[model samples]
Target: MRLNNKTKAGYFNFLGTLVIMLFIFGVGAFLLEYFVYDYFGWAQWLFLIIPIGCITLFYARGRQIFEYDSDGEALNFKNRNVVLFLDKHLSDEFPKYKLLKYDVVNIIILKRLYVSISSKKSHNITLRYDISYLTKKELNDLKFSLSKVIKNNKERKREPSS
Candidate 1:
């Protein structure tokens, strides 16, 4: 089934990047300026703009979709765009992949499709696109193909399974 990317894909990514950039800049400037020298002086502000004008390219991106057959298991997560940020370990524990922007993904069609993708640093970013982004045919096909998995996602995890 054909799926659409997040409605505010650029904006959302921008916001996320901005937050990350600020944190990185804060730490980096402190380290370099404090340890290295006070050489940065006024030029430090210009250096900060590097992150501002950084890349916002979305490569190999098209309609994102999923299949029910043998999905959501322990899929390899070498290169993927995660959406839900479900697994804490995926976000917190893995070595960061850089250069590439979400090439391949290990998907779990949970309450919503959780795309497990990596970010520039060791940051694991998840972007969720709801059914509203799907076309009528694709939505129907998704429902028909994996209704159970979708339903299962909606159930509260804290509650015991019936």
Candidate 2:
């Protein structure tokens, strides 16, 4: 199965633009109120908080695009921030048979997928991907896909190689 949240990238970009516009509007309102009224009103606090709150929320939830491909013999994963230069791009690919286990952490503001794969050096390497932008249905599908791979790996190990 190949899964990607590419469609949501545009939505996130739109939201970012909206947030910036709101911040600009808020600043204009703040300046107007200060210059015309000569005193800060109670509503002024909301203008200040609006942009800060939006920034905090987006930062906590992350702004990365996550793609997972279980096609062919290897599982591929790619995660990169919407703002390309803001963060380094991350990509990982490994054979499906080496996948030992996987876990999805879903907290109120944080969502992440952790995959553990057996490495050639007799150690397990864990890869993490931000899944905050994924919808609940998408998240469930991802979990199901990972579980299927892990089950197959376990079953393959149980069978003796002739």
Candidate 3:
């Protein structure tokens, strides 16, 4: 199984550009109203407030891209911020038998995936990924895939090798 949010990359890029453009335009308009028109009103404050709010929302919500692949002998996952050059990427690949447990949290607007895996050097390692852009069906599919891996791992541990 292979799943990724690559299809939404263009949408996020366009939205980021639009929000920035809006902020610039709003500031420009506010300056024009203040200096050129000598206007002092509540509406003028909205020019600054609306754009700033938009920028804040965009920063909070639409920043990460996630990818998951569960083919062959190992599971692969990748996560990175929308700004390619600025933020570090999270990438992991571990064998199926190493998987311990997994959880998915879906709140009002935030969605995240947490996976626990056994490590040779440590007791366990936990990985986190943002799944905010995934639809409900896609999220279900991801959960199902992780659950299958964990279940198989447990069963394998129970069976004795002959």
Candidate 4:
């Protein structure tokens, strides 16, 4: 899915916040050096490194796409390989098909986002992704595609036995 400017803005916002915090701490350290003591100067530099490292790591990880086939199997993200196994079964009260019922539920829009998918077997899967670099349209499309995949898998599993 293509990422939009909104998502990019979100990432920038996070990075911006981190930079601002580091700057503030650096300023405080400078003041301390002038008025209090120079012993804590290293702390300011160390604090600044953390935010920079985080920003670099975020960019390096790149984007992630999740795709599930009609047979209730998920496509391996890294290798684009098909995984022909089920990790765990949902509980009795909630069936596996329940995951297909929702259009979208519990979506948090931010740098780090969390989504919840409830299965019919009384179990739920929580998907966590970074959306700070995606646009609103891209995010919506991704969600829709995921829902459709889940629905298709559910239907496939319900076919009558021969």
TM-score of each: 0.23, 0.88, 0.88, 0.38
Worst 10 residues of 2 by lDDT: 55-64
lDDT of 4 by residue, 33-122 (tens): 756766765564665566556655644433422232223343211111111131221111222344433333233423444445575587
Better of 1 and 2 by lDDT: 2
Query: Which portions of model 2 miss their true places by more than 4 Å?
Result: 31-43
For residues 4-96, what per-residue lDDT tens digits would candidate 3 score against the true structure? 888888888888789899999999999999888857776888888999999887766534678899999999998877768746888899998
Decide which is better by TM-score, 3 or 4: 3
| Candidate 1 runs further than 4 Å off | 28-144, 148-162
Tens digit of lDDT per residue, candidate 1, span 1-162?
A: 223334545554565567566658766886687568888677666545655434222212322232223133322222123233522222122322211122222233222444444565877666433332244565566545334433344454446868
- How many residue pairs clash in all the candidates, one count each? 13, 0, 0, 11
- Of candidate 3, the 10-residue stretch with the lowest lDDT total is 56-65
Off by over 4 Å in 4: 1-73, 76-125
Identify the superior model by TM-score, candidate 1 or candidate 3: 3
**What is each predicted model's overall lDDT from 0 to 1?**
0.41, 0.86, 0.85, 0.46
